[model samples]
Target chain A: MTTSSYVYYPGCALQHRSHAYEVSNQAVAKALGIELVELDDWNCCGATEYFSVKRLPAYALVARNLALAAQAGTEELVVPCSACFLNLHKTDSHMRQHPRLEQAVNEALEAGDLHYKPGSVRVRHLVEVIINDIGFERLGQLVRRPLYGLKLAAYYGCLIVRPDNVLDDVEQPMLLDRMIEALGAEAAPFSMKTACCGGHMTQISETTALEMIHRLVTNASVSEADAMVTICPMCQLNLDVYQDAANRMFETSYTMPVLFFTQVIGLALGLSLEALGFGQEFVSVEPLIEKIRDVPPARSKPERRPKQALPMPAMPQ
Target chain B: MNATRPPTFFDRVVAATPDGERLSQCLQCGTCGGSCPSAADMDYTPRELFAMTMAGLEEEVLASNTPWFCVSCYACTVRCPQEIPITDLMYTFKQMAIEAKRFEHRSTADWSESFVGFVEQRGRSFELGLATRYHLFHHPAQVFKMGALGLNMLRHNRLALRPKSIRGIEQLRAILDRAKVLAEKEAWR
Candidate 1:
């Protein structure tokens, strides 16, 4: 591992709607001998919406957390949530790129008696640290129970890999695939791996969001994957919470359980179900749990996505 | 710092954002429009929005539901051949529409407004509270539609009634206040 420990930022979602992600993440990290020191007094990331309403205040809102993380004096600040990671990474990049933004942001920070220098702290997604710093070999070694029979579809939601994709390829990222493989599961083929999960559109326009959700769930269902593994809380929430809504809208039944990569990793590392918060999912992973505990999926030839008439976009190495 | 509204909506948007000035580099490739998942529901596709922006349709651009409809998935911004920060541009447009108070999709705009208000007030979001306020004021029908889902989440403890305030909420408020001042000072009048 690059370093044994780093500062961790679990944004608001983790505290409420996505607490399971935090639970599983911490369990998995502990199992792997990683020390995640939570950031002190971090505020919301303003998510994807606030920035649109008040640009400067939103930057300050996102920047405040960075400023706090910088105070921790850790070289690496890890964020689990995709939105938080992007906000912090984007702020760091935007600040470094635009000195004026940095200056204005710092000026606001000064009001709270906080100081931050842009680019001083390395902002990273949690999965990147696990895959890169922790190394897949080491990760695979820590797999005590091995996710033997699970056919997993890795869903890399949009924020983590876009415009400035730091962790994975811009289009067809495979970091999640590699991480899932390290956990000893078959990384099932999924075409909508990098597709947007309609994000907050689920709240804005239900019909449109449901359509987008239907596409992702249908594609995953078509793949016959046991469950779709995700890194983002929003992606997991949208997929997990809105299955009924999606089914009602599209008249298609999709029972694909959306599990966080950490949750699955925790299971592979032999963490308890309660510790991993498995039962918290809206779409019960009970059937998948039966597979994990009693009868795991064998390495049988799982169903694959039919060859697309249109070729998928290529990713960088 | 002062009222310097550029004649064109595109120009105003570009001028408003320090980083989004690159919209002029657009190739009209329709990559943004094509990549957008919600484009079918939009009145003006991202490409058309850009065209209208460049055509100096100030009021039309400000009032267009395109910005409100944007889910900020960043799909268009990611695939833009010109490397334009289309998502951020959408944000810039959203702020402009809020200031102009002429949103085509008033309910959607109001939803975003209520959310932002929730975050600013408590330094965190209370999803249940925000939804109730927004639905009751804007689209009361949605409340009933989402009632079961809301109840389920509440029962599961996924949704919380009490808001979670950050430890140094006072500091957070101070930062937000200062930022608001800076934004007002720096925002194009």
Candidate 2:
């Protein structure tokens, strides 16, 4: 049996912006006997821009971390942030394919007294690790309280699915949906699984960002999902914190809670809402909390009435 | 930056972009343009640019000043309903443009030159050198205004007066030269 242990790179957001993600991820991993080792002196993954701006430096930035992970003796690195995972994975792929880029980046690394050989460590998303390494069967076995009637819409976003190199099937990815179902919740059918959330666009431009967010939330809500479940911190923050603003911007009424997949796993493991960082969310999860314990009744159609009065009038005439 | 031979058209196209999918699935809903912070200020939309690229209207897309204006906030990529990687495409296009010598924003090129100079001299970015170069390029007057502040920062050891070179400067140069050659060849292809 492959033990559930891997190096965890929470990236920048989880460390500063979304502390709840980190706390919940750790608690859930610990409960599942998945040891998450933090990389020593790991720097930023350049937040998805540096590589595009300058290929060599971007490679160097990600390569520095890969070298650190290699030194830590971890064969695989588990990244929680979608952007970090993409950047790290892209760097690994590009370095192997482009020798000149690899040599240039390694030279930069040499300046910092660090060296990284291509394909030294495999970079993976937390969702991939949880779904592949920790099988759904094992997940179901660990579930202390099965969320029988809770409805969840799994949101994958773009980074994890697109480019197809670092991801699973782009058209239909069942990892998150499977995980949600394993937790004993009904995975609601929704179409915007691989859609973009207009990340940081919320900071740069609000109107367009809100619309993108609005579509995701409305789709999930219309699908009758109680909450939106996600794997990326950026996606979670965008959906959870920006839901109200997105609603106000679009002038629509939508009250949906965005919960991290780990948080849902934690809840299923009988962990308290506090430990899951449920209170830190901008949109109140109180309504979701109520639903968690009490499942809503299934919708039923009304019975049709008989048309006897019309027949009696016709006979009299 | 050292003067190098001009890149070929194909190399130019390849260098201008990061590795990613193109905008074949774009819905042309204008969401990317509408969401882009720089869209209001630019002549072309991200959708149009992608269309032109796919259509092989390379001259118009590459020659346009649109690529330089991208802030790289990834707003367009995120809001794209079709899941088109707009920002990455923009990056690729910009890189291709720079390598092809079609549209290198002088200001950004100057910054790149100064930054590379600093890195070649010092293993990492030197704050003073960076600030000096930035002021020289963007606003020379700011340097004079903050002279006293700059002296105070140096006195307090907040800024290093002498920039240190990386230990294997020769190897670093050789690596950079090889990258330049590869980029040139890629642009030509």
Candidate 3:
């Protein structure tokens, strides 16, 4: 088996606002024996609006980072943020599809002395990497502190699962659910799994943004999950930092710690709260972590469904 | 003159609006109104506005201050059970309303102007220009405090004093012109 390692693109939010995500992601990956190589000269992903405002420059902004990743000789780029993953993936796809866009973007990149040919690098989400490459069996093996009795609401925010091309499934993505289950935690059956967590909309429109966040948090809280597990930094921020504001806006009392899946994985891997940057969250994970710590390891149960043989058709004489 | 004049229908307000997809998919769950941070201050809810627009109540849709009150947070769109592009629709409607001179919000106009200034000067949003323009427009006292911060940022080599323009300004102008024409066509109806 060829051992796979990936170049990690932590994007701007991970570097600044969601530093806990980077910390947890790195620690968990290290514990699992997967090497996460941080990209050397990565920049902002230009986000969702930049492309709409100015297409060529947005492509160039994303392409510059891709070119850097390619130059570093890494074929696979693993992005933890859904918005970054979408921006990077869309830029790559669009550049390959449209030669004019590619040329203009490359020309802009010339100033930075970086250039990338479209399709040269593959962009993969962290969830996809863990579910596909690491596999459930391997993940199961790495679980020293199995998250038994911990009910988790797997929140896959809009950017990752939208546009259909880069996402696993638009309507119902099971990747996060499966990963949570692999950690020995109960994945709460919630319908708002693929809902949008108002991205930078919090800055542009507070009322509208709060409403969006209120629904996601309310659903997760109502699901009775100890904490909401997410893959994207923006999703984590909107749900975590904005929870209080959203609650106040709605005049509803609700508290749910929003955490990156990596942090949960770190806890499951026997890493300490300090290692996972647990205390860094605005919505305290201390109480939830204590609950997680109390639970015993999950007991292996036999398969419920009986093995059935394929029915053969009777031949007519 | 009154009898000869053609009656303006509700659809006229909504006709040729750019963000029809967002308006069409609102689920009327009241999640938007319930969660909106500014809902206490604003008159109409995003859900209600969407309902009105979908019902083709154009004059009410355009004349109402709901669109201007939107902060563009993806919260509603994100939490939307139907996954409507509520913010995008607001942006489109706000732009249309401004072009028609039917509604005017000074803060929004200032924001748009600052954005345009940034793009025209540096081919991107420069922090200094944005901050200065915003403070100048809204609160001039903010300029002194921001000036101190700007100097500190410059000292740390964060803010670039000289703005950099893209290579093809003419091409950018042509694209902007095309977009303006499209906006005008959408607004007139």
Give the distance in Å from residue A48's predicted Cα in candidate 3 to where it truly belongs.
2.9
Best by TM-score: 1
What fraction of the native interface does candidate 1 get right in terms of contacts?
0.79
Between candidates 1 and 3, the one scoring higher on TM-score is: 1
- Over 4 Å off in model 3, which ranges? A1-3, A293-317, B1-189
Candidate 2 local lDDT, residue B109: 44
Worst ten-residue run, lDDT, model 2 chain A? Answer: A293-302
lDDT for position B26 in model 2: 66
Residues B29-120, candidate 3, lDDT per residue (tens digit)? 98877745455556689888777766767667766677666544345655677756565566555654654566335554455556555654
> In model 3 chain B, which range of ten residues has the least summed lDDT?
B10-19
- Report the CAPRI category for model 2: incorrect
For model 3, residues A159-247, the per-residue Cα lDDT tens digits are 77755346577668888898899888888877788777876555445567788899988888787888899988878877877787788
| Number of the predicted model whose lDDT against the real structure is largest | 1
Q: Select the stronger candidate by lDDT from 1 and 2.
A: 1
For model 1, chain A alone compared with the true chain A gives a TM-score of 0.91
**CAPRI accuracy category, model 3:** incorrect
Tens-digit lDDT string for candidate 2 (B94-162): 655655676335554445445555654543445467667766666666667546545654543344565
Candidate 2 Cα lDDT to native: 0.70
Give the distance in Å from residue A155's predicted Cα in candidate 1 to where it truly belongs.
Answer: 0.3
- lDDT per residue, candidate 1, A6-122, as tens digits? 899998899989889999988888887788989988888988778877888888888888888877787789999999888888888988998888888888888999877888889
